[model samples]
Target: MPKLIKDGRVVDDQWQGEILQPEQIPESPAAPVAVQLEPGQGPATIPCALSNLGLVTIFFPAFTDGRCFSYARELRESGYTGEIRATGHFIRDQLFYLQRCGFNAFQFAEEVDLDACLASLSDFSESYQAAVDQPEPLFLRR
Candidate 1:
């Protein structure tokens, strides 16, 4: 089993279902399908049974790839209530920002320290602007 940062703690990835491509979703799946999306892809692109999805795993092909950030935010804004997992080459430094964009689960490489990455999630006390997790900006909150 692989471990991942989920809801601020390191936990085993409980997903036992196959992660399929958007077009590969079966017309009637036995379990809620988990989909893997490219950086620029959206959940709407899934061929069918969009509402039956349990998780959406977004891949960060490289540390410099920032396009996934927008896709995560877009998923939240579009009312996706399933898990938005961040997987691949993103650094621990980006965890805080990724959470702000609505990624609730993170799967780093095998060598990465889960403890250190969990700590980085709280690197900042607050944010100046509104985000998915924090709807009110600091200015408005005050």
Candidate 2:
């Protein structure tokens, strides 16, 4: 079974249906399916087409590939309200930033110390700008 990190805790994924195998995510029967973007794939008709589907998962392939990061942010800006998940070579350190960019969940490669990683979610004491989820960011609180 795959492990999903939620609320800073590692737990078994309970989604019904065939478990998503390694490098395998089924077509989004819910409408928009998850899309995997490779390096130099170039953004074009695919993203637009998938956006209309519903739920889409933008793969990173590797943490070093920054293209997917941009793709994800663009998708949200384009008005994609569906779920956008980050998979492959993703670490807890990138969670908050990813979330801010519209990634709601993460499929980590291995079982991590949930409690420890969760601590990193709010490493900074505060923030100066509003994020997608946090309207006032952190520092602007009264």
Candidate 3:
């Protein structure tokens, strides 16, 4: 079992969802599927089954593409309260932002050092903006 950073710790990843590609999603699935959300599709365009999925993985096709961040936020707002895993070639610096957008797990590309990635989650004691983990901005508390 490969390890992934989950909620700020390295844990054994027990991911069970099948990675379904775009072309293969039209067919109904018997088992739970983890589909990737690209940069442009609206929430309405996503299959209803996906909203009910227990584990959804956001795909980062490249380092520069950032549409997945909004997708995670949308999924949470839409009431899909399952595990959201950020996978692919995202930079380590994006971990905190990823969590703020509702990603609970991160499966970095094979080249990333998991230890350093895990440490980054605790790099800062506070953030000024509102996030999923910290819904209120620091300014509001003062």
Best by TM-score: 1
Give the Cα lDDT of each candidate.
0.86, 0.60, 0.76
TM-scores, each model vs. reference: 0.91, 0.64, 0.82
Backbone clashes, each candidate: 0, 3, 0
Tens digit of per-residue lDDT, candidate 2, span 86-141: 67777778877777666766676667775677666666655577655565755668
Ranking by TM-score: 1, 3, 2
Q: Candidate 1's residue-wise lDDT over 1-142, tens digit each? A: 8899998999999999889888888777777889998766765677656568899999888968888888888888877878989988889999999999999999985479898778889889989999999988999988
lDDT of 2: 0.60
* Candidate 2: Cα lDDT at 66: 76
Report the alpha-carbon TM-score of model 1 versus the true structure: 0.91
Better of 1 and 2 by lDDT: 1
Model 2 earns a TM-score of 0.64
* Segments in model 1 whose C-alpha atoms lie over 4 Å from true places: 26-30
Task: Give me candidate 3's TM-score against the actual structure.
Answer: 0.82
Q: Name the top lDDT candidate.
A: 1
Give one digit per residue, the lDDT tens place, for model 3 in 66-134: 788888888887777778888888889888778888999998876677887887776678889887778
